[model samples]
Target: MSITFEINRGDLAKAITIALKFAGKERELPMLCGINLSIIKGQLTITGTDRFRLGLVRIRPIPETADGATNPDLDGPGSNIGVLPRATATRLLRVIGGPLDGRSPNVELTSSGRELTVADGETRLTVTLVDEKFPDVVGILLDEMERPIDLDLWGVNTALFAAFKDAAWRKGDHATVRLSTASRPAVVRIGDHFIGCLMPVQIAKRGSTASDWKEFLTSEPERPTRTTKRASRAAK
Candidate 1:
């Protein structure tokens, strides 16, 4: 069955922007070079991964039409996975997602069989699905994790990217930053809205990576405490 829905352009852009960090560029596997756009139930999920790092963003439910009728073309509460070209999707969103007539633009995505169509106002694009299956990005993000840490999503992104850049300079292009996850895959969360994971690269690990994290926590006291502080207080 075909699925069709309208999405806020700003939301779509944010998802795409985050996904681009993990989306493969000029890769052999076509599926690896695209973002996986899925709508399960009413939630819209965007995921991208290069097997080393993965990013997932879930937007709140897309709105129904003013008359309160669910689009009949939807395929119920199953996943509608569409692998879209990252570069093309990014460009499309940038052009059409900006303010339209001084108001936010909303773009419609229609999936029928193997093709996905995107349209905003007079601009429309029909992209054929890559003839490959997208890897399970969410599953990879959740797997092999000993601890989940709460951090600002933007902070994680900035620190990791900087670390990645530094590692590449000192080590090689295949370098990785050690996420402070107790010798396991590092998973980070920002409330319920976002989650990201990065695999550890095999190399001599660095020390004192926790100092920046400590400072981050000190600055933001509302972050969920990993330990039972209340229990400790009662014991004391």
Candidate 2:
């Protein structure tokens, strides 16, 4: 069967933007440099990950027809997974004009084997899908995320937190990260539809943080045992 689904043009633009965050850099992994697009049981999902960070967005399709009918174009079973090149995603977002475009039309995405066609009105983008098997996002984003993080310090690459940058929803939406332990990857969640994971650095000296993650919060924060006033007085 063919893979054809209807999604709001604006929403698709945002999804592409969010997915691009986790995409691999050029030459890092040729296959992973694109957004992993998958349709499971007719539900579409967009994913990007470079091992260090992972981002996933599920684009809820526009509701079916008023009379209730499935997409006629998807009558036969075919490949439900495809990879959209990162360059294609960015260009498409430009074509879509972000999430707040005045014309929020329905975008049709049709994929057959390694070919994908994205069409909205007279604008059409045809590209060859990346030939690669994407990491199992479903398996990665699983129960490990549910584990609550109980620790005084959970050190992760701050860069990983920026996964939410220019996210489809907003530039910086509050995210809740749960890191069970340094050995495991931390769950980074932003809102409902968007979720990801950030792995903590190995703990060398501390057996928790691989690097020397100094606690800047220290140094007499509240009572201030060593105050600037004291330093000035001693200087005199």
Candidate 3:
């Protein structure tokens, strides 16, 4: 069976919200490093984790096709969604995050077995799945001890990125910044007021590319915020 779905910016935004969190973990098996998207009982479940934290989001698909006629050029009509490797999937989402007009573009996801491809009009992203089963993330999430605290999502991201970048210049094993939740939410004091959220971390690639790093840094609050002590390793 095949499926053709027209994804709008809102839908794409929500998917990225879920996908980025799942991609922020250390993977014992390389394939577990990607987000898993599966259609179950008429809803789409997106799951991600880095062993310490796990993020699971359920999304309902909007029917973008009519008359049962497959978009032919697009995957035909059905409910078969695909799993995209975290890095590639993250990148794919960024490319489509702009206006839905042709410039920003829409992406088409297709999968068979462990291989997944994300296509944007003429651009294509192909990734080979890591040949290992993702660990049971839900179980780990259930065992966590801390009660979830509410923080300003955008504020926290801005502060974290600034802290991570500032720590990059320091020489040490630990760098810590304590955010006070007394006045306004912690994240807003720093910047990034557009998207408010807490996300998990999954990938560990280093880079100076503005787009890539910016997207990766601010995608989720689930990613561990590294202080000077832990940040030193990444600095070198």
Candidate 4:
């Protein structure tokens, strides 16, 4: 079946911006330097991942229709996945303008095997799909995780985001944000829609408290105050 669909440029751009966090950077794996766009169950899913982190956004497009049925032009069965160069995709989305534009731009995507064409009005962008298989980003994301701390999306994005950066500075790189019952400091966890593990900037050393030191100091019996007979004899 032919793979072609038109999506609201503004909506597509918003989704891309959300997923761009996972897009890989230069000097990284070429396959990771692209965004994976796929159609599954009538939803267009865009995913970007640098292996360490993943970002995904799903959009259900409904073209203007007289009847309240799904847009046949954008709806189809089965799954079709394609990788688009991140740079090209980003540029294309940016050109589409925001949702508040005087005229809503429509971006058309048509796929032929390894080539996917993106067209917006008169402008068009064609990007080659990467051959390398993308790692299971979803699996990594949904893998067995401690129950996440539920918080408002805005709070996490704003307050928690700044806190994470500050912690990274004090704790150094690769600090882990451990989520566990034993963790005294509150660890923020959101719903399934958004999950993030930030490396902790600083972690208190376990068993380093003054009370712990006092317990250790008093736990052991005092070393025998009496000197050994052999030492005493030597001294004599």
Give me the runs in candidate 3 sitting further than 4 Å from their true place. Answer: 1-6, 27-32, 66-83, 103-107, 120-123, 137-236
What's the TM-score of each model vs. the native? 0.65, 0.75, 0.45, 0.58
Per-residue accuracy of model 3 over 158-209 as CA lDDT, tens digit each: 4334323221212443433232332222211112111121233322343333
What value of lDDT does candidate 1 attain over all alpha carbons?
A: 0.63
TM-score of 1: 0.65
Q: Which is superior by lDDT, 1 or 3?
A: 1
List the candidate 1 regions with Cα displacement exceeding 4 Å.
Answer: 66-76, 102-104, 145-183, 203-236
lDDT of 3: 0.46
Name every residue pair that clashes in candidate 1. none
Candidate 3 vs candidate 4: which has greater lDDT?
Answer: 4
Error of 1 at 126 (Å): 1.8
Each model's C-alpha lDDT?
0.63, 0.72, 0.46, 0.58
